[model samples]
Every structure is written in C-alpha cells, then in structure tokens.
Target: MTFTLATWNINSVRLREGLVAKLLGEEAPDVLCLQECKSPVEKIPLEQFAALGYRHIVARGQKGYNGVAILSKTPLEDVDGRDFAGLNHARHVAARLENGVVIHNCYVPAGGDIPDREANVKFGQKLDYLSEMRDHFRAQRPHKAILVGDLNIAPREDDVWNHKALLKIVSHTPVEVAALAETQEAGRWVDITRQDIPSGNLYSWWSYRSPDWDAADKGRRLDHIWATPDISGAAHSSRVLRAARGWEQPSDHAPVFATFDL
Candidate 1:
C-alpha cells in the first residue's frame, strides 16, 4: 500500500478546526497527525472531519492544554498513548494500520524560555521526557514504524534561520538537540525530512510574535517525521506546507508531509 502522511501542530484544534478541514479538502493526505489539540477527546469536532471522509480517529486529549490526534481516511487500530516522563500530559499517541505499519505521534514539551534545567522545571521535564523516549526505544527497537510530531527541538544547523543566534534559545539549544539525537539513535529512526531535503534552511514553525513572520523568515524545523531504517527507503516526497502558515489566524507551525510505498 502507498499513502501520504502529514504531521502538524494545530496549536488548538478546536479553534482552528476549519483550517484542518481546509487542509483535508485541499492537500488530502491519507493520514493527518495533529498536536496541541487543547480539547478533551469527546470535545474534538469530529463530525466535520468525518463528513470529509476522515472517519477514523485515535486521540489523547486534555482540556485546554496538550493533546494529540490522528485522523485517517482508512481504518486503523489505536495503539494507545504513552505518558512519557510521567508528566500525565496527552503528549503522545500511536496507531497501527492494516498493512502493519505503526505510527507514533508525539508532542514534546516546549522547554521554557530559560534553557537551564536547574532554573526551569519545564526544561527539566523536557530532558526527562526525551531520556525516557531514548530508553523506551533502546529497549524495544522499532521496525516498520514511522514517528512524527512537534518534537519542539531543532537539531540541525540548517534547521533554523540563524543557528548560532538560536543556539542559546530553547528549541535550538545544544542540550535539547543532543537529547533528541539520542532518542533518534535509540530507535534507529531515519529522519525522513532531512533524508530527502538533505540541506537548506528548512523550517516548519515561525514565532507568532513576529509581526511579519513571512518577511522575517526567522523559523525553525520544530516538527519532524522519522521512519525505521528497514522501510525508510520507501519514503519520499518530503515537504513542508509553508503557505499554510500564512493562512488567516493560522497556527504558527505548518504541516510537514511524507509519502511511503510499502
């Protein structure tokens, strides 16, 4: 089977459910994974999505806070969500397709403005969450799996507009970057985005604070898509729907896409 997948930080799925519908109408990926839904599972506006042929959904949500969901055009079985770091946040969810491929969607905590773990409790939690991810993947090696989400870390120099300038910032900081790397290594996951794009100032997220985000173009590749090496070769057409960021009242982060033939 061949299918296209997209991952996005919708920020607040309910607030921007229309944007989600618009994307589903236009881009029409087979599967869409969303983070920061900020609504209880029962409260997610699924009727609208269901009318558009996205009849299957698996989600973990928290009222007015972190949440994640996966909507698929085809039938899929829920693989449940994990509370990484025991944070009790709806930060992760997984599903399995009939073809046997597993999809893991995650929303890593955004470490606060202060990067120092000692100075910020959120920063410490971020590190601990990543450590648990690394340990989990190390113990249970993944195969024929694709992991996607707003990981909230930009690991590569080219992932941000100004690497040096943002190094001290939360997302591009070396400590967070290293932790993400370790997790990826533990899973033996191939970064499907970088593998296809290879190089360039690739970005999926722009700060909402920027008055003219498009003109300034100070963005970071905080979202990601990764697949296990065994089936990584089947993945292609990696891209970021940059124009989505320009939509009216849009999410700061745009959608990232990849296709796989398995």
Candidate 2:
C-alpha cells in the first residue's frame, strides 16, 4: 500500500477550519495529523473535514489548549490517547490503519522563553515530558509505527536559521535537543524527513514576530515525521509545505509531508 501522511500544528482548528478544508481539497494526504488544535473533542468542526472525505478521526483535546488529532480517509482502529508527563493535557492520540501501521499524533509543550528549568516551570515540564516519553518507549518499544507532531524542539543545527543565535532559545536549546534525541533513540525511531533530505536548512515554522516572515526566512523545523526502523525504509518524498505558512491568516507552522510505500 502507498499512502501519504502530513502533520501540522494548526494552532486552532476551529479558527482555521476553512484552511483545513482548503488543504484537504488541494493536497489531500491519505492521513493528516494535527497538533495544538486548541478545542474540545466535541467542539472540533468535523462535518467539514468529513465532507472532504476525511471521515475517520481520533483525537484528544482540551478546552483551549494542547490538542492532537488524526484525520484519515482510510479506516482506522485501536483509537488511543495518552497524557504524558501527568500533565493531563490532551497532547497525544494514536490510531491504527488497516495495514497495521499505527500513527501517533503528538504536541510537545513549547517551553517558555527561558531555557532554564529553574527560571521556567514550563521548561522543566518539557524536559520531564520528554524523559517520560523516553522511558515509555524504552519499556514498551514500538514497531510499525509512524510518529508525527510539532515536537517543539529543533534538534539539529541546520533545523534553525541561526543555530548559534538560537541556542539559548527555548526550542533550540541543547538540553531540549538532547532530551528529544533520547526519546527518538528509545523508540528506535528514524527521522524520515531528515533521512530523505539529509542536508538542508529546512523549516516548517516561522515566528510571527518577523514582520516579513518569507523575506527574513528565520524559521525552525519544529514539526517532524518519524517511523520505527522496521518501516523507516518504506518512507520517502518528505517535504515541507512552506507556501502554507503564507496562506491567509495562517498558523506559524506549515504542513510536513511524507509518502510511505508499505
């Protein structure tokens, strides 16, 4: 089977339901995973997506923060979600395709401005969350799984526009990067996007602080698509939909895509 999957942090799905429809109409990936939906599960505007043929959805959501959803054109089973780090935030959801491929949609906390855990509780939470993820994966171990999300950390130097300058920044800090690396290692997950495009200053997120985001082009590759080693070789055609960042009233993030031939 051949399928294309896309992941994006929509910021708020309800506020940008039209944009979601537009994407479903234009790109139409077999499955689309969303993070930071910022809505309750019952409140998500599902009819529109269903109208676009994405009828299958499994999501975990909160009132106005941290949410994740998986919308699929294909049938999905084993609908599951977990609250990592004991934060009780709706930050993750998982479902299984007919092909036995389990897709995990996640939204890691965007640690606050201060990179220091002592100064910022959110920063500590981010580290603790990642540590828990590593422990969980290390204990259970995953196979035939694809994990995608706005991981909130740019692990590679090339992932940020100015790596040295952003080292102290929350998302590009050395500690966050090392923690994320440990989580990936625990799961035996391969960075499919980097595996496909090994060398490039690729980015999926641009700060709204930039007056001219496109021209300044100071962006970070915060979103990611990863697959376990067993199925990693089946993945290809990884790319970021940079143009989506310029869409009308768009989120700071753009969609990341990868096609898998399994």
Candidate 3:
C-alpha cells in the first residue's frame, strides 16, 4: 500500500481551524499529524475535518498548551501516549493504521531562550524529554513505525538558515543537537525529509517575530518525519510546503510531507 503522510505544528488547531481545513481541502495527505493543537481532545473541532473526509483522529490535548493529534482518511487505532521527562504535559500520542503501521505524533518542548539548564527550567525539561525518548526507544526497539513532530531541535548544519549564527540558539545549540542525535540513534530512525532531499538549506519553521519572514528566509527545520531504518527505504518524496507559511493567518511553521510505498 502506498500512502502520503504529512506533519505540521498548527500552533492552535481551534484558532487556525480554517488553515487546517484549507490544507485538508487542498493538499489532502492520506494522513496528517499535528502538534501544538492547544485544545482538549473533545474540543478539537473535528466536525469540519470529518466533513472533509478525515474521519479518523487520535489525540492528546490540554487547555492552552502542548497537544498532538493525528487525523487520517485511513482508519486508525488509538495507541498510548507518553509524558517524557516526567513533565506530564500533553505532548505525545500514537496511533496505528489498519496496515499495522504505528505513527507517533509528538511535540517536544522548546527549550527556553537560555541554553543553560541551571538558568532555565524549560531548557532542562527539553533535555530531559529527549533523554527519556532515547531510553524509551533503546528499550523497545521500534519497527515499522514512523515518528513525526515539532521536535524543536535542528540537528543538521544545513537544517538551519545560519549554522554559526544559531550555534548558541536553543534549537540549534550543540548540546541540544547532540541530545537529539542520540535519541535518533537509539531509535534507529531515518530522517525521511533529509533522506529524500539531502543537499541544501531546508527549513520548516520561520519566526513570527520576523516581519519579512519570506524575504529574510531565516528559518529552521524544527519539525521532522522519521521512520525506522527497516522501512526507511520504502519512504520517499519528502518536501516542505513552504507556501503554507505565506497563507492568510498561517502558522509560523509549515507542513512537511513524505510518501511511503509499504
């Protein structure tokens, strides 16, 4: 079976329901995973998405903070969610398709501005969250699974707009990159996006603070789609929908896509 999957950090699914609808209406990926939904699962505004033919959904949410969800045209079975770092935040959820393909949708904490964990609690939480992820995958050894989300760390030099400029920045800091790399290594996850489009500066998020986000093109590959190495070769055609960031009232981040012939 072949299906297309895309992941996006919608910021707030309720507030930006229109944009979500627009993407569903236009792009129509077979499965869509969203992070930062910021709404309770019961209040996710599913009717509109259902009307658009994406009737299957599995989500974990909170009142106004981190949330992750998966909406699929294909059937899905709700799997467990994990609260990494022992933070107990609504940041991760999993679902399985009829094809037995498990999808893990996550929203990694954005380590605060300061890189020093001693100076920032959130920064500490981010590192701890990644640490737990590494341990989880190490213990369980996932297979035929895909992990997608706003991981909040850009591990590759070409994944950011400026490597040196962002070296000390939270998302591109050396420590955070090393932590994320360790987690990926533990999981044996292949970055589908980078695997397909290997050479160049690629970004999935642009800061809202930059008024001329497009012209400046200052962005980071904060979001990702990763598959277990066993199935990584089956994945192809990965790309970021950069135009989505230019849409009316768009999220700071854009959607990323990958096609899999499983």
Candidate 4:
C-alpha cells in the first residue's frame, strides 16, 4: 500500500489548533508526525483530531516546550519516547505501524543564538544530544524506518537562502551541521526531501521576524524526512507545504511530506 507521511514543527499544538485541523483537511496525509507541540499530552485536543478520522496517536509532551507526536489513521504499536543523552527533554518519540514500518519523530534542540558551544550551554547540549543519537542508531541500526522532524539544523548550502550570510547562524553553523551529518551517516538515512528535489534552494522554515517572508524568502530547511536505506527506494513524492507558513499564527516551520509504497 502507498502511504503519505508528513512531519511538521507546530510550535505549539494548542495555540495553532485551527491550523492543524486546516492542514489535515487540506493535505490529508495518512500519517502526521509533529514536533514542538509545546503542550502536555493530556492537553493535545485529541477529540478534535479524532473527529477528523485520526484515531491513533503516540506522543511525548511536557508543559510548554519540546514535544513530539505521531497521529495516524492506522493503529500504532510499541510507542517509545526516550531521552537523548539524558537530556530529559520530550524531544523524541517512535511508533511501529501494522505494516512493519517504524516512524521515528524527533525535535532536536535548537542551539541558542550563539554559535559557540564554549559560550553557550545549549549549544553544547545540542551537540551532545546529536552524538548520543549517532551512537544509539549506529548500535541499533533501524531498518525500514522513516525518521522525520525539525532537526533544527540546515546541513547544506542549498538548505538556507543565503549560505554565506547564515554560516555562523545557530541553525546553519558548521558545528551544528557536522553533528547532524554524523547522525545521518550513523543511521544511513537518506534525506528524502532533498533526494527528490535535489537541485534547488529549498526551505521549510521562515522566521516570524521577517515582515515580508514570502518576498524576502529568508528561510531555512530545518525540517526533514529521512528514510533508512532498506526502504529508500520506496520514498517518493516529497514536498514542503509552503503556504502553511502563511496561515494564521502559523508555526515557524512548515510541513515536509513524502509518499512511500511500503
């Protein structure tokens, strides 16, 4: 069967509840993986989503930050939310579908304003978190996995609107990019979004600070969907719903999606 999966960093599921429903109605992806929910699991407005036919949900959430959820039309099993490098943040969650496909959703820490780890504790923690991810995936070696989320790092020059200008920026810094690359290599994950749309300037996030976001187009491709080598060929029809960024009080990041014939 062919299934469409999407990943988005909603910023706060509670705040943008309307946009969530709007996205479901418009895009209609079979599985929706969300990050940065910023709400407790109990406050996720489950009934509202259920009314729209998303009956299955697996989530990890805290009070006001760092949450992830996987909402699917298909039943999910073996849901897991584990700490990365003992960070104790609600940043990772995973579930297995009946079709034997595992979906791993993550919201990697956004290293603060400063790019230097020595000057920033958050930056150091971000690097450590990625290191732990690399170690864990290298040891476990997940197969037929679809990993998606706002990884918070733009690894390529094409991922940012102005590579030279954003080189020292938090999300596009060399350290952050190198750490993300290490984790990608350890898991042998193919960046599905980039794989299909390779030769262009692509971005899934535009800062709210921009007055004319669409015209200025100063955006970053912080959100991503990656598939393990075992099912890489099945990955197809990837897209970034840019219009979502223009929605009412929308999240800083947009949805990234891919279709897989698994």
Q: In candidate 2, what are the lDDT values of residues 124-228, reduced to their tens digit?
A: 999999998899889989999999999999999999999999988999998999999999999999999999999989999999999999999999999999999
lDDT (10s digit) by residue, model 4, range 94-131:
99998999999999999899987899999988899999
RMSD of every candidate to native, in Å, equals 0.5, 0.7, 0.6, 0.8
Give the better candidate number (1 or 3) by lDDT.
1
User: What's the TM for model 4?
Assistant: 0.98
Model 4 regions lying over 4 Å from their true place: none
Q: Which stretches of candidate 3 lie over 4 Å from their true place?
A: none
Give the higher-TM-score candidate: 3 or 4: 3
Tally clashes: model 3.
0
Q: Is candidate 1 or candidate 2 better by lDDT?
A: 1
Sort order, lDDT high to low: 1, 3, 2, 4
Predicted candidate 1 versus true structure: per-residue lDDT over 91-147, tens digit per residue: 999999889999999999998999999999999999999999999999999989999
Quote each prediction's TM-score: 0.99, 0.99, 0.99, 0.98
